[model samples]
Target: MGALETMMPPPKRARLNGVEIGYYEAGPREGVPIVLSHGFPELAFSWRHQIKALGDAGRWVIAPDQRGYGLSGKPGKVPDYDIDHLTGDMAALLDHLGVEKAVFCGHDWGGLVVWQMPLIHPGRVAGVIGLNTPFMPRGPSDPIAGMRARFGPDMYIVWFQNPDEPEAVLGADTTWTMDFFMRKPAAAPADPPPSASGSTFAFRDLLKMWDPSSDARERLLSPDELAVFADAFRDGGFFGPVSWYRNFTRNWERSATLPGRIDGIPCLMITAELDAVLPPSAAEHMPAFIGDLETKLVKGSGHWTQQEKPDEVNRLMLDWLDRRFPK
Candidate 1:
């Protein structure tokens, strides 16, 4: 077993909302618990490093695989993966664990979900931490139209709205899929990443767009660690995770009624200096909506900030956590 497998807490399961949630819990039952939500193509295993550190500091840490990933249940319908169900899963997890509220920290798509907990279920959130993803208030129009206009139809998010194709591309070659995603960017990309560099690469079109061996990006996981994802995904398949993108329109329609601004809660925004998809600038306007917000930048880091710079992310989290809520 790798350090990750050895250090990771034993897995636990609970029937939450409409699915069985696979989670890992540590530290004491007391204190305001911290729930970790992971992003696309990742599992609670992504938070393995933070889990032990935060738990050892006497903070209750809960990391769930979320629906459709890892040991968690994957419902058949695409609508089942909507924002309401995604956020509802965590709220249900809290009830299962017998906790009232928790400091929800999420990264990637998970970041998007944690940002909503306070709005959808206002009473169940103690604090909010958005890693790489910033708090995005609803735009005047449906985000899908904008995303399609901005990123083009072939863009991963927009393309995912189509059934079978996206997941088919991913599930066809599981090994290459994991390797394509779980890597540290080269100081700069050998080619641009759909940035304003006058170049466009549709990440969803992985088969033709980017090749695994063509670049020098570093591996974020060991062979053993990589297998954990490869094997689980081999069994779990990619539909559940990819279906999350399919809910863009439904999520928008439902969220139209939730409170737009977040106030009266401690929120932290951690930005990655090199995360082009969600750069520091994306979070600049966050203060306009979040009454009490603190921002930190992880230097020379990419999208996988927590795993890429675990020590720095942990320090920033612990320092702010200690000051805001005592254990």
Candidate 2:
């Protein structure tokens, strides 16, 4: 087992905005603070490799469980997971830590939160970096409405709107869900039957096709590394994590005015060449929305860019940090 396999420390808790947040801290006491946030079905352990690298490089790093996952307080209401509340959690964390502002890095849904942070709590972020997900400007309509109209109700995000059904379906077997969701694109086969020509496809339905018997962690992570995630889900259940999806439209409505507006915040977006969920193409228009943006594509990786290709992700992030926020 590699060092990262055991890198995650026991979570330390801090009550922020009436919700208790669980987070792991590392690196030098006086180093620049960087808050790393994890996405759906992920905990701070998702940043284990990056934490080790950055900590070794003398940067202070904190990876949180966010609002609803891990040891953090899970506010059962879907409305509580909106972007403003999500971004507020980060700002509050900095306050709790006595940090004026910190570099923020996030993956997957966490990436979405970081992008919104600069807009929602601009003063609390020194810089922002995204993994796998990119900045998508708010459109003429609520994203959920457009997604439902285009892709229909079976779409993952749309399907997540109902609340209970998905929670039961995904939570029925947490271990299976974790193993299934963590499949790296390079290792897993595409859904056998392709989507109808020109019609939108349901991502959740496609996920149903994955072989539950095949544990992706075997190829992607050590048993210990995988356990960290599995244990968290087992304890927290899928409600809080899935609740993130339930707030798509609410988040869009909350951040509508900020999108497409130029922000001087230095941004680094890293895409995984093999990520189907947040494909590299999604970033094509980012330059128009972000004035200071740098993009990197990690070949041979999937949605779990930081975990699947840690070394590459860390190198790209640290290099960007040194250049953007030099010590």
On TM-score, the leading prediction is 1
lDDT of 2 by residue, 255-321 (tens): 6567454477788989888787788888999998898899998998878889889999989988998
- Give every collision pair in model 2: none
Query: RMSD per prediction, one decimal?
Result: 2.2, 2.9
Q: Candidate 2 overall Cα lDDT vs. reference? A: 0.80
Model 1: per-residue Cα lDDT over 1-327, one tens digit each: 665468689999989997999999999889899999999899999999899899889999999999999999989999999999999999999999888999999999999999999999999999999999999998888888988877677777787888888888888777778888888867842334563322244666555566676867888888888888888888999899998988988888988899989999999999998775677889999999999999999998988999999999999999999999976
Q: Please give each candidate's TM-score.
A: 0.95, 0.91
Deviation from native of the Cα of residue 210 in model 2, angstroms? 3.7
Which candidate should be chosen as best, given lDDT against the real structure? 1
